[model samples]
Target: MAPFEPAALPELLPLFYRRLFPHGPYGRWLGYGGVVKNYFQLREFSFTLRDDIYVRFQSFSSPQELERELQKLNPYKIDIGAVYSHRPQEKELVFDIDMTDYDDVRMCCSSADICSKCWTLMTIAVRIIDRALVEDLGVRHRLWVYSGRRGVHCWVCDDVVRKWSPALRAAAVEYLTLVKGGAETVKKVNLSEPIHPFIRRSVGVVEKYFEAYALVGQDILGSPESWEKVLALVPEEHREVLQDEFPKKRDSMQRWELLKGRMERTRRQGTAGKSAPCYADWEIMLQFCFPRLDINVSKGLGHLLKSPFSVHPKTGRISVPLDLQRLEQFDPFAVPTISSLCEELDAAGDDAEQEEGGELEPKRRARGRRAWRPTCGSLSSLWRRWNVHGEESCGGGVTCKETSEASLPPTALFLLRGHCWPQASWCLGTRRLQPNPSAPLNPFPPFGPFLHKKH
Candidate 1:
């Protein structure tokens, strides 16, 4: 497209409103050129009557060029939602975040390239909206699109949400911003439980992206086995090569390093401003670095921050510092186990009904009972055993039972409770007596609430 001045809102206001704000009662005017310039120069808008307006601009032209041309007009942050059809006679409010430090070029480039970092931030913004309006408040809404060249416009349609006051919007934004910060903290905390729910959801998506890129990396690396594993993790559309042709040849790590060096050189020499070109060039460089491996560096370290592993501040290496017990709270695997157990219980009921109806019944239950097998002894017993054994073996030469002394004392009778029989047996000796299945697992004293006592 030929360079043309951006349309003046005064002359083109009707057209702008028709095209961009069809349903609004009134629209805000954004003057792009000398009208804005002369307004500042003359300290009044009255002088703008005759100033020549520059309307056409190069899409790729730097913001510096635009700044040089328009002395009075810097890029203004426009909230599309605030635009109206007819000027509301009522008090009007606007929701806008301070954009003082934001660089327009960076913003434009990031949006244009769909930069991973920028994409993450934008997606997080969407998620905040989703969580606040949909999940928290139980408001049902659909996001509408604005085909803004540089940035997205999300139109919130829920009547209840649309009526939200400016103060409410601001509060929601603040809460969302806090959640964003908490998402970042996941990198430091390494404990997933502390992460805000919205952040956890976003991080899960980002992790899947990483896994996809890693698969691509493996494919490029020529490690067929690793590539297959990675491929299996991703969608079929993401796999670029046939399963049989995946590279089997392995190259030395140094060769890959050399290839990366060459790729970096190419990236630097290439037009650095073009995001797509940069991404493409980087991919090419990766291919050269590890012809056999598919390294997805495009997504970058943003994914690493989302993982439940903390990166060391100085070394920049990731480590798992959160205890396993804490990790289980937010773990998807563990959460589903409860539901699976419920399903199993339902199945068991069906089995009981079949038995009563004289239908053939299986010897053992199809649904397995829940159990806990102790992996190690309690702190007290471990300490005592260490004392008895010193640095060497214990003099008694007795086999160390894996049971926790805290759960079952030496003098306590082994009572098989619901599912605790097999689970508790690891800690309790196999010499334990089998009590009636209907009897209480714990009769009294130390057993207390932990075991079932016969009435």
Candidate 2:
């Protein structure tokens, strides 16, 4: 991947919004069947301009209208908000995970920086959280997206999830949250015997990567300074012994084994006090590896989240959706930047070997749409999962009983409202739309609790 140049955004964004934005399925995904009257029209969109000029409560009559305004404004960032009447009517239950929250445990990089070694934390997070959402909570459709910078976001789009109350959202977050307290707290995770099945499964996910991620990649016990933090999480009597034994061990793996031995010995002897946790090893693993969430982002219905496919202004990277099937292989650094994509499209169009009306001519015209084919494919796949009723494709208006949405072609199902569309094309042709910007309104009202920070 090429290094993202922030200075080129002004030149790159117009081309991006024009050719690369996945507008068709994006509209379908947000429309949600128009189950409620004027659902799409009532939803809010907020845009941030070049000079930090913020515009909110921007509503559109249709997806075409939204597309037109997007080209007109060329927003530096786009945030999706919930539909509203007097208050927030409905919104997808969302979750935000920032890598910075794990600064205390991660050793490879600090603050907003990330590398392949530390990126495993994100992989672990997606696996654990996604499993719980599907198996435990019974949610069928979940859309995961890279934050374009240092984190990941999940939008739970089950029809029932949209109407979840704040208290219910809090409960779900609480269920997923294991590592607690702030930086000052010495031991963030405290575990006891007979651990819940959820915690056990979560630990199973963490254990797969713990040996390589923590012991070798992070080297949590390699130095006295770092081992001191690990020792603090262990029992009081064992810390002094581990402190003496750590330097004697050959490597971090050996030191970790020694620590594990002490814990196992204590468990087998039954000599530990009631105050001491027998499952401290698991707790330590959870503390260092479990997903840390922004509870405020998940709990508030009115809170706005960065829209999927929104470009990170600073990095010039698009927030593309994640394929759970390829979760382990996902690489944040490999995601395409606006500059690289534009160059790819330009290069494809300028191919000298191609004849004017040959087979390559159609491909040249489709280049703009295919530039974002991976992203559009993700959105299409998400729609397949979302539209479980097996409704016919936009071209075919007939609904077939007992037919799975997956059985139909993805492009046909892309438009959920049965709008007439070409069966062979994934391209939703460009239209220049000019929308009047709504007057800016305060996103956070005095009465309700809303997430203040831009997620």
Candidate 3:
């Protein structure tokens, strides 16, 4: 295969869309019941073409049309946008977050460069928001996708959420936002006596990572150069006192303790003074630790976000679905590029074909024999490859179709990269759906055939 570079996208995208895209599940997810006429058409698709030319308001009548168009344009990036009232200009509610916005707290990597140390910020963000979305709002069905770059985007697609009004969306954003104030304001987060339950919950999340993330990983107080940045968060005479005490401390851990002690003394001194903000040590930590969301993205109803499975042109990586259970261990660097995935599919196909040629017809028909396909592997083998627990790849907790947190491994994708593209079918469970024998031979009309549901 040619080097998987930006230059290779025009050549690679068509093959990926036509041969490798998981159309059956993808269509099933978007269509829901296919009851809402033009439900799929109501969706907005945006594409980033070569030379960074972006095209918007692109809608497809059917998943087949979407497949055909994708093959034709071979776009570099694809974004999913709000379902609209008329044209895509009139959009529905949506939310998005970027890691770049959290640059103030993240020290390991800046801008597009992200290491595992800073990656934990994203993990924290997802957990906090996922909990609130489920517990507070009573939402169901959310899809989380890796941004294919420096961050992650969560698509809150619960049936009621998509229909939420702009006012309700704005209220939701306001409820989630903390660490307010701009560059001019020294104190971003302020906590009063008896912090609110929402803030208390946030503090619980922050304390979990404070030492590993802030003190050790960032070493925010390791030097006069760095400690001053943190000291600035403190007010007046106390800042100078901590500055004097911090250097004597051996590491960030001890320095943080000193900082906490100072805050405690100030709190004891009381709210009698107007100048000092009645701030807890936890408030500063929350400011530094909490996920900084892109308020405008979630605030606007018309906002668009990058679609999952879209190839990030810069990295040559696809935006795959994230598996939440293994989020702490999720590494963006491991995701496969278009070229790599294709190469894997090709190699797996060669191996399967070789095995088929060598086997006798009787043996080939055995239940264990993997059915050969160009890209999609046999359903039986797919089930075996996805065996994470006693359960198949699919987990009960996830809202997305992914059976795991990581992208489809080449072993799984190549195991069942379907030959029929969008029409691919799999018998996911035990026992085939008995189509009336009197009915057409193709019980599953839209998908190719009735799958043998395994026990």
Candidate 4:
């Protein structure tokens, strides 16, 4: 199939927002019960227009007002900033992560380009942060969204998390950070053990993926140059000995085996007590595999992240949610573009194409609304699973089942998994979302604790 055309976004976005946008769920998500004065109205939105013009501090009193403004401007991109005390210019706490900052560790694409090869790094990062957010800091409502490009954004919206001061956010980022030093530093991960439980869990997560990601995918020991770099992580004395012996080994896998065996034999011979410290092969691997987070992004309380479901102007793809259940299976290429969704709407037949005639706004909305239902027909099983009753489309209603204490957040799971969207869909039962219980299929099964957060 052919790829998306960025040039068509200006024409498609208006109609996309008018008919296909999940304004109801989005309104419900932001308004969040109007916890403060006009919560939805107090939240900030940034619009990226054609020619890269950026407009910020725009808020609406209600979802309807927001939808009208969106249809009017047809912004190329939408960024959601933190909810504020007053004018959104004063940003608040909203922790996020940018994948580009990890370029130093990844051998794959740099800046905005991403492929399945480096995407695994994101999985590791998510695993690390997701666990810590729950286990370490006690956050419950964490919403992770794909950046529509190379990274992911984590929104820790637990009311308790929201109230955290900027200092606490900075402290939290500092706590999660481990692989330190810059490009100039050779030994980034220093494991003197008695490691924190958080890092220990992170290391376990890396162990699960290292062979596939590093030994096979990255080929960190594939050549003499790469081997020498891995060797640099060892002490200078041990490095010389390993350099002499590793060449006799063949390929990355064999070389890695030899490196580890050499370290063990030496330590057993008590050579580890000699002048320099010897890092276990696992330590070297952990250094190579640990998540390289963007410290500033998480540390700063004022950072704005692209709203979940925002269309990337350049790629024309929707910045959807990440499916934590099938995270390893989440494919960036599978995300539906705004143009593609519009095309699906078009394929519903020209009766819809012609519905744009000078009919009253409500009449056209009705016609447009009916035309788009086929695109959403795939979501039936999901709705059925959630036990969503009533099928209503907003020509202009701003709601989703009037969320209750017992009900899941209207957009929670859909945003959690990243693809299911009407976007007003919600989980009706009291069951909480659990982490994937399946094993990783390697030496160890997928081993993280299952998470079940109630909304």
- Highest lDDT against the true fold, candidate: 2
Candidate 2, 1-455: lDDT as tens digits: 45779888888888877766767656766777565678788899999998889999999999889989998999999999887876897888999999999999988899999999999999999889988998899876677778999999998877788899989999999999999999789899988776799999999999999999999999998999998988899877777888898999998899999888777766776645433446777889999999999899999988999998889998888786665655677778766788876775565344422323345555553443332233233333333333333223221334433323332222223222222111111121222111112412211111001111121
Tell me the whole-model lDDT of each prediction, alpha carbons only.
0.27, 0.72, 0.63, 0.63
Candidate 3 segments exceeding 4 Å error? 1-3, 87-93, 264-280, 359-369, 372-455
Clashing pairs in 4: 321-418, 439-446, 440-446
Model 4: per-residue lDDT, tens digit, 1-455? 12778888778887677656666556656766554677677777889998899999787879789878988998988888766765333333444555676676667678877889988888888888888877788766666667777777777766666666667777888888777888788788776535578867887888899889988998888888777778878876677877887778777888888777776665555634544334467578667766666666655545677787788777877777665655787777766677666665455445444454545467554545533233334222223322222122111222233222112222333333232222222232223332222422111111111111122
- lDDT by residue for model 3 (197-292), tens: 777787787778788988888887888888777877776667777867876889989988987876766677776753454464776787787777
Candidates 3 and 4, the one with greater TM-score? 3
- Candidate 4: misplaced stretches above 4 Å? 86-95, 262-277, 350-455
RMSD of each: 28.4, 10.7, 8.6, 8.8
C-alpha lDDT of residue 148 in model 4: 78
lDDT for residue 14 in candidate 4, whole number 0-100: 79
TM-scores for the candidates: 0.27, 0.79, 0.79, 0.77
Model 4, position 259, has a per-residue lDDT of 75
lDDT string for model 1 (37-100, tens) is 3211211111111233322211213323322322233211111212122421111112121111
- Estimate the lDDT of model 2: 0.72
Judged by TM-score relative to the true structure, which candidate is superior, 1 or 2? 2
lDDT of 3 at 134: 68
The true-structure Cα RMSD of candidate 3 reads: 8.6
